[model samples]
Target: MSKTMKISESLIEIAKPYAEAQHRSVPKQIEHWARLGKAAEENPELSIVFIQNSILALAEEKAGMATPYSFGE
Candidate 1:
């Protein structure tokens, strides 16, 4: 369950128009941006392309085309 918190008016103002343009709900658009921000912070050396490709790879795995990794001698 997610808790509702007060958001900054300026932030909501920024997100609302973009959310509408992207056909996403306001909260969902904020969530998407939050995910990107968190990922960038966690992986400073990674490019946006790399992060996007990783998301695609996870989707493929969930659809059953997984390539599990193993390191062995």
Candidate 2:
């Protein structure tokens, strides 16, 4: 069985620029980080940047606040 969840439209909007900057689609970006998260659980060398950034992005969206970070800017 596969579990599912909903993502905020605001979060999607906020991540758009970053995803575009990385030349990745939003789904691909999320998958990339999901893999990173899994790998981080098994490896110590992976940076925590994605974890922190994703959390902050989600929190900002939930609170109806603007994102403070942007890639390639």
Candidate 3:
């Protein structure tokens, strides 16, 4: 369920390269940024790098790419 909305040209320009690089549509790239911002706001103590890695880890898990972690004895 998506709706049409107006966004700044500057934002579109900024998102274009990132969207292409990430293999996501411009809207999806913006959505990903929004999600990152939301998580950052909610967990002020967490670094952006950590948040990004966590998101990637979750995505990998959802896509069945995660493996069990083995701790060294």
Top lDDT model: 3
- Candidate 2 lDDT over 1-73, as tens digits, reads 9677787788788778878998999876776667667767876665688566766677789998975778898
What is the per-residue lDDT of model 3 for residues 17-54, given as tens digits with 9 covering 90 to 100?
Answer: 99999999999999999999999999999999999999
In order, candidate lDDTs are 0.87, 0.76, 0.98
- Measured against the true structure, the TM-scores of the candidates, in listed sequence, are 0.69, 0.46, 0.88
Q: What is the lDDT of residue 53 in candidate 1?
A: 79
In model 2, the worst 10-residue window by lDDT is 43-52
lDDT: the better of candidates 1 and 2: 1
Report, for all candidates in order, the number of backbone clashes: 0, 0, 0
**Residue pairs in collision within model 2:** none
Minimum summed lDDT over a 10-residue window in model 1 is located at: 48-57
Pairing residues by index, what is the TM-score of model 3?
0.88
lDDT of candidate 3 at residue 51, scale 0 to 100: 100
